[model samples]
Target: MFANALVSFEQMVSSYPGPLMLVTILCPDPHFKKRHHKRRVVQKPLVDSILKNLHPGGQVFLQSDVLEVALDMRNQFDSHFDVLEHITDIDPSVLCDNEGWLLINPMGVRTEREIHAEFEGAKVYRRMYQRRI
Candidate 1:
């Protein structure tokens, strides 16, 4: 069933029967306006909830066409979770460094928005993390 992820993510995580193996958040609204930035979806509370619900080795994949928003997502994960290095077969140049900021799309599969952005020559940032034991 559909649920408001922002409000129900924690509950869903808690009630889930088994460990969540993978979580992907793609193209979250940037909320560009300074006044609306606070309303962005990727925040400390949600990150915390994800961490708590994640299995020790579960993976979290996040991507955004907006560099600033991607960086914010990285910051949120860095603060709460031990960011993981890129494990894809893609070019190493696209992988995240010690700071966990990916310069390319590691998933290989592009979202519709991502494809459109790429067609317009937009830069997308991505990050991946694994829950530590």
Candidate 2:
């Protein structure tokens, strides 16, 4: 794993000549403090680089327990990429009638953090966006 996504993005993309089919960012550190916000993983430059390397119709999956962080990711994708759809496999009632965010885990595989969050009874928001020329 790269220590810094922004710094390593160029090299990572160049190393793989073939178009990337999918990129997943799950439960990233929110860096809640305003002063540390810059350290957050999902930023414009990284998002732009991901879009640049992603193949057309390829999808990007993002999930976070923090609603603010999840919405920030959605805004980034909406601004830079064409959002094809939002994937969910959960009951509407469980989400408390919130239609703005995804309720289910799109990626079948769950990260350790996600599993723990669920055990703690935390709400996890997810979003899936497609890159289109």
Return the TM-score for each candidate structure: 0.81, 0.83
Q: Evaluate model 2: give its lDDT.
A: 0.76
User: Which regions of candidate 1 fall more than 4 Å away from where they truly are?
Assistant: 81-94, 97-100
Which 10-residue span in candidate 1 carries the lowest summed lDDT? 81-90
How does each model score on lDDT?
0.76, 0.76
Model 2 lDDT per residue over 1-133, tens place: 6557868976877698787888899999998999998988889889878877888778788889888898888888777634344333222342322556665675778999899999999988877776654
| Tens digit per residue, CA lDDT, model 1, 1-133 | 6776788899888888988878889998899999998888887788778877778777888988898898888777767624443344233545565555676665778899889888999877777776665
By TM-score, the best candidate is 2
Q: Candidate 2, after superposition: displacement of residue 72 in Å?
A: 1.5
| Model 1, residue pairs in steric clash | none
Q: In candidate 1, how many clashes are counted?
A: 0
